[model samples]
Structure formats: C-alpha cells, structure tokens
Target: MSNIGNYIKLLRESKNYSQRKLSLISKVSNATINRVESGISMPDPDTLKKLAPALGASYEKFMAIAGYLTGENSANNHNYTTGGNLLLKEEMEAIDLISHIKDKNLRTWITDPSSIDYIVFAKKLSDMGIDPDFVYNEFVSRIMKKNRE
Candidate 1:
C-alpha cells in the first residue's frame, strides 16, 4: 500500500513518540499525523522537512520514500552491496508479498527480519538462475493459491 506511511509509522514508533508528541515536536497537527499514518494522506515536502529531524531520520530518506526524489539521488540510500538496512529493498518486496498470505497466522513471520536469511535467499535465487523478482512473484502466487483453496 503506502510505503511512505508505513515508513513514517516505523520511524515514529522506533523513537517511542506518541502521535501527540510527534505533532508537537514536528509542528505537524495530530490530525494530519493520524491521517498520514492511516494512509489517507501523504505529507508535503515541507511537512517531511519538519518530521524527519523530529523522528531522527534523514530528510532525503523521507523524501525518497515519499517519491519526491528517486532513491538513487540520495547518497544515504541503501546501496546494492552494503550500507544501512542491507536488506531493505528485498525486505520491502517481501513485506509487499506477505499481504497475499490469506492465512493470517502464516503472515506473522514475514515482517520479522530474523526469520529470513537474506544471504541464503539471494544466493539460492542466483544459483537457481532465478531473478529475485520472480521469487517474489512466485511467493505471492503460492500464497494466493492457498487463499483460493
């Protein structure tokens, strides 16, 4: 759904800030913050500027998440080989794929980074001559099949 909204919520929660507190610190209204969290709206660049520092995250990260700029434009973004959140792009795809897992119980582990071995996943995909994207689609397809059963 809304990566930006999910990212904002993740940032806010990591800081242990309540919506009311974030609103006060960022000068963003509580209602606006709530709406953004609910995925009902996206914040403007100005709002992002205020919120990023308040949340202790980089503005470029938020702007890139918001689609204001492509991730490639930001030096702080995850590099293919290394940097912060080494699995972010892959993990994000995994998160998107989990929505297809209709059995709510089975979906629980998808968001847990520790549950996956990204190195093995990548190596196996490569060894199989499979594209990472293909595995993502296949995982979702398998989940959909379960839903149909």
Candidate 2:
C-alpha cells in the first residue's frame, strides 16, 4: 500500500473509526476510501482536503504525502512535480482556489475539465494575463506568513 494509504488507515484505526464512519464524516464514498487505502487509487486534491480534517491531519501534510505539494513552501515552488513531468501550474492554482469556495457543488463543477463552468473559469484566468512567477512568489509569501501566525 502507498504511504498515504497506510497513514490514513493507521489514523482511522487509531481513532476507532470504521471505513463507513470515515466515509460519513469525510463525505467521501466508502468504496473510494477502500480503494485509496488499498492503494488501488490515489485520492485527488479535493478528496485529500476532505480526508485531512476527518483524519486529524493538516491539508498541507496530506498534499505533501500525496506528492501534490512540497513540504517546504510549496506555494512558492512551481517546480513541484509528479510522474516525471512538471505538474500543471493551473492545476495547483485550481486546487488552492477551490479550497476557499463555500459551495461544494460549485467547487466540484469548476474542477471538472469537461464542465462549461470550468471552461469559462479557465478562460477568465487566461484573459487576466497574470504572471505565473509573480503569483507563485506571492502565494508562497502568504503561506509563509500564515504559518508564522
């Protein structure tokens, strides 16, 4: 099993939580949790966000374990990668952006690449002409500041 899967299983066992219980608390399906625990599938960013609080862990910690974010100032590092290719800058921004969204359905809809909402959102960001490097540095700075709080 993957390190993350083992970690989650251990945490669940320690908390005396059944898979069904975790599913209920995390709002992630029991079958998906089982698949994640068995290493048959890796949980995505949204799943990690849900499971982290339920597992009594930090979202950043889980993201690091899942190879989504670097342990050190991940927001600052656009070079963070997985599967040998540079991870998409847009995907990282999407994950961070979705985390703050209050509407669960909207978050899911925006994350779906095939959705019209996702297309429009992506278009908006593209039209902004934002500088990636500046954004990365600013995001990292904010995270560092938050950690100091």
Candidate 3:
C-alpha cells in the first residue's frame, strides 16, 4: 500500500473508526475511502479537505503527504511538531494546559510552534488572568469557521 494510504488507515484506526464510519462522517463515499486505503487511487484536494477534519488532521498535512505540495512550501505548510529544546517554557506550559482538550487537530496545531495558530494561541495565553479553556474554545470556533471557508 502507498504511504499516504497507510497513514490514513493508521489514523482511522487510532480514532477507532471503520471505513464506513469515516465515509459517513467525512461525506466521502465508501468507495472513495476504500480506494484511498487500498492504495488504488490518490485523493484530490477536495477529497482530502473533506477527510482531514474527520480524520483529525489538517488539510495541509494531507496535502503534503499526498505529494500535492513540494519543496519549502510543503515544509512551511505542514504543521510538524517541534519538541525538546525547540519549545519555549510558555509553549510547554500551553501544551500542558491544552492536554485536556480532546481535539486531535487542535492539539497537533498547538504543538507546532511555527504554525500561525500556535503563535496566536501562545499570545493569548500570555494575557494575564486569561482562562485556558476560553482560549481553547475560541481556537475551536476559529477552526470550525476555517473549515467552512
């Protein structure tokens, strides 16, 4: 099977979703999901867009994996997490605070310090007396709005 197909299958199983369940939630046909997972076909941008949220991943990440993006652009687009010495103390603290959130996409975005979402999230957390839960909810709201656009 193709690398992207394996990646999707791993993520789907991690979420405990069957192919039919993923299809139902993602609004992609079961045949499409089967084709993707079986490495019979590659998903296009629109298909990946539909599947991303349902699979708890970002469309850019899927795009990168599907070879839709290339070179430095792909590196810039994908939200690959940087850890260890790369994380600032505030970033570490923010990650810890957000650990309770169940949204995998949000968690992935927040973990990548280079992501604009993480920058905005870190700035919000720096505000005195600001509630972490409120920040998380706001980010969730923003993500929902973005997905609609």
Give TM per candidate.
Answer: 0.55, 0.49, 0.53
Q: For model 3, how does the per-residue alpha-carbon lDDT over 1-149 read when each residue is reduced to its tens digit?
A: 55567557656765778999999999999999899878899998999999988987667666766778777776554553333122233543443355455777765554443563556455767676677677878989999999999
For all candidates in order, the CA lDDT equals: 0.67, 0.67, 0.68
lDDT of 1: 0.67
How accurate locally is residue 116 in candidate 3, as Cα lDDT from 0 to 100? Answer: 37
How far does residue 105 in candidate 1 sit from its true spot (Å)? 18
The candidate that achieves the highest lDDT relative to the unseen native structure = 3
Name the better of 2 and 3 by TM-score: 3
lDDT of 3 at 43: 91
Clash pairs, model 3 backbone: none
Query: Which residue segments of model 3 deviate by more than 4 Å?
Result: 81-149
Tens digit per residue, CA lDDT, model 1, 9-96:
6556656679999999999999988888778998899999999889876676566667776645554553322234433555455544
Please tell me which predicted candidate would have the highest TM-score against the true structure: 1
Deviation in angstroms for 25 in model 3? 0.3
- Indicate the residue-level lDDT of 24 in model 1: 98
lDDT tens readout by residue for model 2, 46-87: 999999899776566567667877645665643322322233
